[model samples]
Target: MRKVLESLQRGAHAGLVLDRFGPLAPTDEKNLPERKDRHLTAVLEAAGSGATRELYALAFERRRSTSDPELSRSFQRSVDGAMVIGLGIASTLEAGLRLHQTYGVPFVPGSSIKGLAAHWCHRVLGDDRGGEHREAPLWRKEGDYHRFLFGTTEACGAIVFEDAWPIPNSIAGANGGLRREVMTPHHLDWQGGKGAPTDFDSPTPVGFLSMVGRYDFRITWNGPPAESATIAGWLDRAAEIVSCALVDWGIGAKTSSGFGRMVEAETGNRANAIATVAVAPVGNRADKRSSGTPARVTLVAARPKGGFDVQEEGRALGTLTLGTSPAGLSPEIGMTVDVQVHNDDPVKPQYKWPVASKPAKSVPPSKRR
Candidate 1:
């Protein structure tokens, strides 16, 4: 997901093509305006006319008291439905992310959409009784829904590509994970002159990601419309919960890896402003006491005299005074600290994390994940 953001920022059209169910009706784009940003382009490319019914049935319906032929047909429908849903989700998220980024914000990532969908399946199956364990179980038996449903994870969990036949303008990772590659205005015949490019030259810049989630579950019905409506209402509630989970976990792709912000106010350039962070041992008190015997340890900020401030929850911890030199400065308290430094002018934010690199061996083993 971090790599996806980098790809977009570099001007690549990150394509997320979903393969699941049958085709859907053509969309009415006549009223839709031509989008200029990379994000919108990606969404348009992701649009699919399929339903997810087939994939869902194949993965969940074999357990029913239906015959193989009937279930097989249902499974096919589920596949078509899943594919269509996947494409629609991809398109919607692509557009939403582009809009957020254009406004200098972030939206969730497509990978998150997949993860949420997968989890939803896990939950529905896991909670069901009279079936094998709902959690993903290996060695699924033939005709077992568990085997069919969980079996697709290997195909759907990660985006992959085929060399023989590829997307018209798809981007590929070194190991060939399909990256976000959408169409661009330059490639649109409606805007560009003759010989206009038909594909993306680079991935789009991701400002933020918009998290999109959908879930499908069966509801018992004795043939009453009111019961059906009740089921619909329950699904809505589930959707809301899924949205909350995505936001809480930071599980969705929303911003550049190292540059994501907990609080994103439209302040001017902030890079020029110094950054200071309060570091305190948290979690178990016993663990904190055993590791740290020192009364205090020095904390550092990015700049001198930028007036870095610290806070915990909403209370003011204290001001961080940087000395004339770049040497470490001792903190005043023991509480966990959050530092803030902002200026009137917009500045490119700098990060302590490397832009691109894995854990270095220079660090101790305990520090390495």
Candidate 2:
């Protein structure tokens, strides 16, 4: 147990354990050279069979004014996903104006940032055109996965958040809640403000005005696979969903007009972030066939909202083998995913509570209920 945790700590500061299988030996004489090989073997044997519980968490940021319809609509329609935008009447319009001009635009309306993130999701989902229903579900009732089981080439997914910010003014108002100076682009009325002219005369405020905008996407899934093929299948679908969300904001695909970055403070690395898929197995009902290991399936975790459709049961998230083997653990296993981003933005800390431990062993399958 310490070895496994050590290996994971080498890479990430925080981590969560996903679908699990039993038969892993407690530290003891039962440990053998064959033990590692045996464990790997068990994991590989389970490919494409099915297992239990899939989850995901995705987050993004927006800058918009309080009155934008897009912000409200995005949240109202975001039954599965949530969005938050920055909006604050700059403590001083002159300060806000200086910041706006620095971004190479006449104004940095909060709505524009909000639209950028929505568009980002749209691009990720590959649905920029917005014609088809890409079937990204929060979770589906089980049997659907088996319907296309053996020959199934397509996969489904979903996205969600707890809040939606469709405009810049909204963020400005919220900012004061933190008791900081409120400043945003939209609050500046260039056509008729104190400046008389909209363009910048100097760069001081412009530099300070360049506030950092942020977006976050997190997902929990059910597998670690040996190939990118399956992961791609999931990613392609996820990208499509993000695209649709952006389109709703009137942002089009491949447009410089709609752009922003994905920040993962969890790691200092800042590149366009991609999916970080993890795996865990469900409770027993093991081994589809009497093989050295039980057949395992690979599954990615995602929110239950958004429109991506997926089945709740029998979806081959990848298989689970009771024992472990390195070779067949799936090439996709033990890999790190980095999000695409730029800028060294500071992060705010949030409150959290400590958790208690649980009993290690499972009761017999017969007594699961």
For candidate 2, which ten residues in a row score worst on lDDT? 10-19
* lDDT values, one for every candidate: 0.26, 0.26
Give the per-residue Cα lDDT of candidate 2 at 114: 33
Off by over 4 Å in 1: 1-111, 120-228, 253-369
Instruction: Write model 2 residue lDDT over 1-369, tens digit each, in one string.
Output: 755742331210001110133224547845543444333233222211112101111111223223233111222111112121222333212222112221111122433433344344334433323644232221122322221211122442122222222122222222211111221344254544655543654322121122222222222223333244444444334333333433334221212333222222234333333333111111212323222222223233221332111111222332221122243333232342211111111110111111223659868989887
lDDT tens digits by residue: candidate 1, 33-138:
3322333433333332112223323433333334232111111001101111122344433332222221111123434443553454344323424554332231
lDDT of candidate 2? 0.26
C-alpha lDDT of residue 249 in model 1: 27
Best by lDDT: 2
TM-score of 2: 0.23
- TM-score (C-alpha) between model 1 and the true structure: 0.18
What value does the lDDT take at residue 30 in candidate 2? Answer: 56
